[model samples]
Target: MSVDRFCETMCIATIAVMFGCVACITIKTPVGAISGIQETLTVDGRPYRMSTFLGIPFAESTAGENRFKKPITKAPFLSTFDATKNPMACFPSHLGGEIKYGKYVNFSEDCLNLNVFVPHSFEKNVSLPVMIWIYGGSFVEGATAIFPGEGISAFGDVIVVTVSYRLGMFGFIQSADGKLPGNLGLWDQHLGIKWVHDNIQAFTGNPNDVTVFGESAGGASVIFQSLYPGNRGFFQRVIAQSGSALAYWAVHATPNAEPLIAKKGCERAPDPVKCLRALTPRQLQDDDTSAWQPVIDRDFLLASPQEIIFGNSSHTQNARNFFASLDLMTGANNFDGAVYFRDVWPFIFKTTDMNTFNLTRGQFTGIAIPSIIADAIKPKNHNIASIMGKLLDFEYTDWQLPNDSATLLFSLTNMSNDVGFFYPVVSTVKGHSSLRKGKTYLYELSAVPTTHTLQTPNWIQGSNHADDIQYVFGYPLYAGPRSTGNYTEEERRLARGMVTMWTNFAKSGDPNQPEDARRFTNATWAEYDLNSQSFLHFTNQGALPGSRFEARRMQLWLDLIPTIALMETPQAHGTGTVHVPEIIIGK
Candidate 1:
């Protein structure tokens, strides 16, 4: 039974015992607090109250004139607010699909409200660590209410906050005229963090111990926030899963390119906004315009993460402190590259049209591909076989494409992919090593596990994109889709190990607690350093000590300089560390 139901039963039993008659007792929350009609539940054996306040405005809804503009915080709300119902999602079709998932609910433009979960007996003085999650749908399609925990209040042990912000075009659109603003979604995160910082103490969470975490796009956002000048102290630590600074869809303008096509589709509409607003959510989904993403605003993203890490950018102000105060933990699922490489091969395969493919085959061969491979493999000190073995595995069967096809494709794909995903991660790990030596952790998901499903009895495979989400959020195993049959029994065990590691990290900067080893042999997690590059390797049994992943390949890729230059501000150089490119030539 849920905690609320259990509490109600006990309350009724208490009344019957005291009065010698069964009676209904009025259970109200503590005065002046965000109240819920729902009864409180016990957390760690302590009575904890929970509440969800729907539609507490965070910004002017991004509809009509407000479209493409930064969000404005709502004026203070008056009167008691009841958070009993699920609020509307941030303006529907932000992700271009209606009921994308059968359960995907639609929300609104004025969707600035947040859900607050607090334990009933939470004392004002006992400061709990806070975890703020930024849900990912490639920068779209997430609402504050849809996450697994039911509401922010469900996390009785720790103060958890989930935000509802604009997504896709409504959140991250940019106009060529420089008229349309970018990253409204990012601004919403800033506002949300600020809100938590100002008010979480009332919920018994420590603002100083805040750790921002997310999966996929949300993971990328956490990395982005780590490097954003305006975001310091808003969060002290970050946990990123799946999405990375090196991924192709992440760094290139491709995320926005599709919308240009959408703009073309919208150009013919009688009224752009009205047509977009009026179309059946499905029709808008068909328009293909919703892929808008966060771009460098010169204000929030002073430079792309590449320039910051390579220490090659000229712009400095508002950027110097980007990595100055961050403590980080990040990793990728084993098969993240599976779905990742599939998505980009077509671009490389159809490179004849620069308008469509962007880079020519020769450009890919002589410059782009080579540059990327060099950076990814860091071939200077290693042989081609050694570099390829660790960083990439080619197959002669279904996995291998004849001749140089696979090699070229892999290089092109991983080039941008590494920069977008791994590079930022490496940079973050390294930065923490230099700046916060005692407090950084990195992990790699290696195990796959079996799970039961309605259609099949058991299906399992290695970790794929977003696979780590359930573990990190402590969401129930049966909540969403199950894994494939190929996944090992050990993968499930690793998932539990991951949860403990994350919660432990959330409570304190260190990922391993004193008792972690009791649960699994790999309980001892070492802080990352350049020499050890220590990282927790997730396997069937649990996590184990690991280092040296594609070392030669990674080294080779570090030799070449990044082609795209970093954006510059006036005060300081935005570069945090020098990122040299290295390459590996596949034999």
Candidate 2:
């Protein structure tokens, strides 16, 4: 939906914590009055402050027959529910009008609502550490009021939030006989991270020091909310930048909700979820969102993320109760495969405004190999789709960009950004570094976004998808040519070293500590084990953080992509060579 204005930009950065407001100070909030303002955040050049709080109602008003069910949270109101505007953007309806920031947004279906901020010099018996953003439109068009949260809650003191769920197909649907229990858009992001872990400690925050981050389908909904056992105490650490939960469009469902509620006329009606919850949200935003999203539910996607990443859970007992020791930092974005290379740019110049740049390689392999082998479920060989288009044209045949149709549009935009976001964020950091019970970190962002919005011409270079959200939320300060609207001493030293390494990994799960590692290194960003694949590489020519000794073409897309890897366990399948597939199907 609006990844920095469709891979471009128009400058909209504010949200670095708020801490104060000159006058409007009304407090009391189980569900009401939340006046605020006063924000800043310069870090390493100094300027702190925090307290923002806008549009607060953690839940309630899901609108009409509670629009397909499950998120209630906002109840006890008494009036003054103003919280100073900016909260409605949930009915994206699968991006009709391609949804570019929907006229600076306000769309609603009573949009769940959330936005907290906090920082101004703590105290009230101190409690900080909290961060919760979850934006990414493949869950059918994002919204958390387009994330801004005041410079990482005043340059990393902490307590920052951003939420709002339910998208395309009104937050995913189901019912071939499942009485309608699809993942209510992941239970509206698990009731907005359980209403901020039961009311973010009245805004001082520290509900077991929460952390839940996101990007691209909100980083696969922070690995499906760290694979719920009913989300133990809401959150405790996860960052998943590019995206994961083994993407092939992160677990698509669709067992047939009768041709998706018969595109909203309510198929064979008689209460098709109350005749598709009384239509009009522009007729469910224009239907066909390929049967909405995320399924396989016995209650919130119960199994098969290859049986919850290979512990093969039929139901709890094993699989470490769905691995929740939870310390994760996941990564992505080396041109996050240029968001599927801006729709194959006229199929790599073979042109289509009614033909002509010359099209052939068997007509772009008969239009991109039968739509990437009918969107996944391959490997039963029989020349698995010409051996996956010659193993992705033999590792994305690059002949150095700028010609041959931008090198076949940079090898089909890094094979659709390496099977949708770097082979599922390096197979979800090799299944949470083979779960020792949490402790994993890895990165790779490759900067260079001095504004782009998919202009798609000048040989397209670094940083693509969601160009590192204004250097991880401190915003525009890349102030070089003494540019007035600021930010450019190398984008203010990479937004004060990525908002102090994402608020020192949400206040200590280790982000190379020592005040976010004294402006980037004396070393220590390790922990991505299975032996030194130690990454950190966040560059725009700053370089340095780079040791990556593993990549036999990412071991042939994690041993021959049975739909983007991740389900390899069994003590790492005897050091990889393929052979690993118990179950994997299609979208």
Candidate 3:
């Protein structure tokens, strides 16, 4: 039977099963028949009917013996599966006092499901572009429930799929031996993408046209997925927002699995994986204090992301060539640094309120700068770390207003922004653009939301980390349960423009192509090159094209600091410690 006829028959069968009492849609996928629910979404004054297939298992449950191992593809179902309700989130790992997206409730190790949202207007013969979303919660906490794709799917005219993967110890735990190789989370994501590529055609999605996009750690995952030699044809384009694989926190050279294993009384076991598997999920999750991140397993990652993306060795060249084959779009927010200050100086500041926070010149010079340098740079040599810190202190200090607390706060925020978000994102674009193969576009989100959710200090001036997510997903038009506040008309227009640009990129390699989409902004987004460094600066007003975002700051971090660190030696500092200059408060 034809695909359209088959879909019609399946929908009829579903209606017959319910005695025509309920509205439902069913599609006969390669694996089995799945039933979905139809919903109405209103954009502007028009209501669009959307088909939502939720909680479809892409892979088998990673419980019991499957723990810490690569996810296996889920077997076919015997009967029509219900894809109406949201799936359970993977067990979340606790981050001490870190404000993440949602509370962990109704979680399980069997949470390897994905959700599909399609426009109801699409027929089975219509081939729509597919955009898969991978969420970010610092690789610890995130759920498909929090990120509803109905808005994007209905508005963008594309098939949207949100994927859920294993998290924390359940996903990234590794053994000292190779028995429990890490990166199970990445493997799960791979399987999810594969399942979508194979079965999306049944839902009127083009298998060959796919774009994978994500934020923060999810952004880093998009890069990693593109870097994998095996994923050449899995995706054609990638959009990484506010995250890069080269960031210090993105990949862990040495995973601290011993401490967690010892805490669980599995340190002395004959087989660590077996011992850990024997424990209950609660026992394993409650005591997992270690920061579980992706390790450089020889299979997934041959070397560090830095080595693969920046190194000139033959092996790295092959990886870079593969990465360059896909169209890339990446960037970060303007004030992304504000989020890291709580952890960077936990001793000095207990809260994000700058009015209550106090700092002296001595502390800023002697302690704060050094602490941030150590955290951001992670220099191998102690002398290099000290030198970089001293240089950064000199670069960031506002000499004219040395005693002003607001100035100090602004300076610190700038320093943190460069180290955490700006530098890494710029570096990623540079690496991709240098190859001169596939198209690369860069952007910086400078629009501060009027409706605030994060506890950003009043002194901070620009968008905080993850702030751009709302506009990208058209959240202003359709705010779900996690709505921060009511958005303004301007914000709604920005959301419409953002959705258009993002969907445009997914459909074609360029964000400006097909020029007939509702034009909210007159400014054209320029392609990023190494020399020009052109980027789109997103603001509440609209997108404005600019060149060399933070040109001076980029030079300081990318060129000057590294050069100084390389040239300086122990003798330069004398006594193995650099002496910090005293700055009187009144002076």
Best candidate (score: TM-score): 3
Better TM-score candidate (2, 3) = 3
lDDT of 3 by residue, 1-587 (tens): 85544655666566556434335777789989887877566754468888888889998888888888899999997777777666778877663312343353367789999999998744446898999999887677788877888777878889999999987887776666777788888898889999999999999999899999999889988888888877777789999999877776677666557778788898899987789899877677743433677778878887677667666667556677889888999998988887765444554554445545766777778777876665556566778777777788778999998877777878888887887778878888988998888899999888878754456666666788878888888888774455555788888888888888899899898888654434776678889998889999888888888999899998886677656655543323443233211110000
Residue 336, model 3: lDDT of 83
lDDT by residue (371-392, candidate 1, tens digit) is 4444343344335424344333
- Who wins the lDDT comparison? 3
Each prediction's total of clashing residue pairs, residues at least 3 apart in sequence or on different chains, is: 67, 22, 0
TM-score of candidate 1 on Cα atoms, chains taken together: 0.71
* Every candidate's lDDT: 0.55, 0.66, 0.77
Off by over 4 Å in 3: 1-22, 95-105, 121-124, 286-290, 342-344, 347-355, 515-518, 565-587
Q: Write the per-residue lDDT of candidate 2 for residues 125-173, one digit (tens) a residue.
A: 6888899898887777766656666665666678888888887667776
Prediction 3 global C-alpha lDDT: 0.77
